[model samples]
Target: MSWMSVDIGENRWLSVSYYCLRQGVSSGFRMRNWELQGCNDGLSWQMLCKHERDLSFGEQAHGVAGWAVENATAYRHFRILQTGKNSDAVHTGVLACAGIELYGALTLACCGRCAALVEIDGRALGSAAMLEGARAGEGVRGCSRALRRSGGGTRAAAEKALEAKGRREQREREVR
Candidate 1:
């Protein structure tokens, strides 16, 4: 089996609940059984999810194929391990992906007090004064709006973070 991993750039916590995989220009390639794992130290790992059936783009040349979890797990690193593939008799054992999207909330614990200092496109959105006066929910909403106004990838990231936060809150309520 071949595998590839992505280091989320930091050891911060993230509640990754959704993933989208887009196929590259090559249409013939497809993945069979695969596993998605998460870890904090990169050495000790835990399986987050697995797919036994085949995952493919089918007739679509470039499209998104994704999945979402009811309960998200917090981790700092993630990996994709491909155990099998669907191909002709002569298999070169090469798997390629055009792009992958991970959606989740960046945990407040990861941000600490500095979360209020987050910046987007060189502009500071979560100023100390704003965070001090903002309510819990209001702060999140404000940040989301600021990120959207800033535009580009920052907005997307903020959206995911808020989604994850919402999901986490929901789960906690259920538990209580």
Candidate 2:
């Protein structure tokens, strides 16, 4: 029903924990689950984790925990989702909340002498320098690397760019 920032770190990973309880034994559990969402700005949050019950056991604690998405855009806020509540419910009880925490670090890659950039395409697109120095010509909209072919191709040196499409087309024409 409510959300708050629990903690922070200079790093990129985030961890958060919280506790809740029913108004009374007969009133029943007012909240059934918890969720973790993320956002670039503090405005919109995409659901990272969802619909989880209390992680603790036999402790009679309504505490659910979730982790922030790795490499998620910096989050300025967090939220809680609540369900299963009614006004006349005799089983209702006030839930006490406490001990919330969050932590994270920057996401990066270092492999030997070569480093990979996160959120950038072509790093894992097969051979290095294959798609290097390639560019899409003007008026050309965009190229989808998802359809890129790799290995044993005639255009092996071609990077996944709009320009590569032009080169591949020219090669096909020459072959004909």
The C-alpha lDDT values of all candidates are 0.58, 0.37
Candidate number of the best TM-score:
1
State the displacement of the C-alpha of residue 66, model 2, in Å, after optimal TM-score superposition. 6.0
Candidate 2 per-residue lDDT over residues 73-162, each given as its tens digit: 444455554333322245332333444444442221222332221122343332222234222211111122322222222233243443
Q: What lDDT tens digits, residue by residue, belong to model 1 across residues 1-176?
A: 76778876543456677787776565555655677788889998787778776555565556568887444567778887776764423553556567777766554322333444544445444544334444343343233222212222334445544455567679999999
Q: Worst ten-residue run, lDDT, model 1?
A: 143-152
> Residue 29 in model 2: shift from native, Å?
6.1
For model 1, the superposed segments whose C-alpha errors exceed 4 Å read 108-176
Looking at candidate 2, the ten consecutive residues that score lowest on lDDT are 135-144
In candidate 2, stretches whose alpha carbon ends up further than 4 angstroms from where it belongs are 5-31, 52-57, 61-72, 83-95, 106-176
- Model 2 compared with the native: what TM-score? 0.34
TM-scores of the models, in the given order?
0.60, 0.34
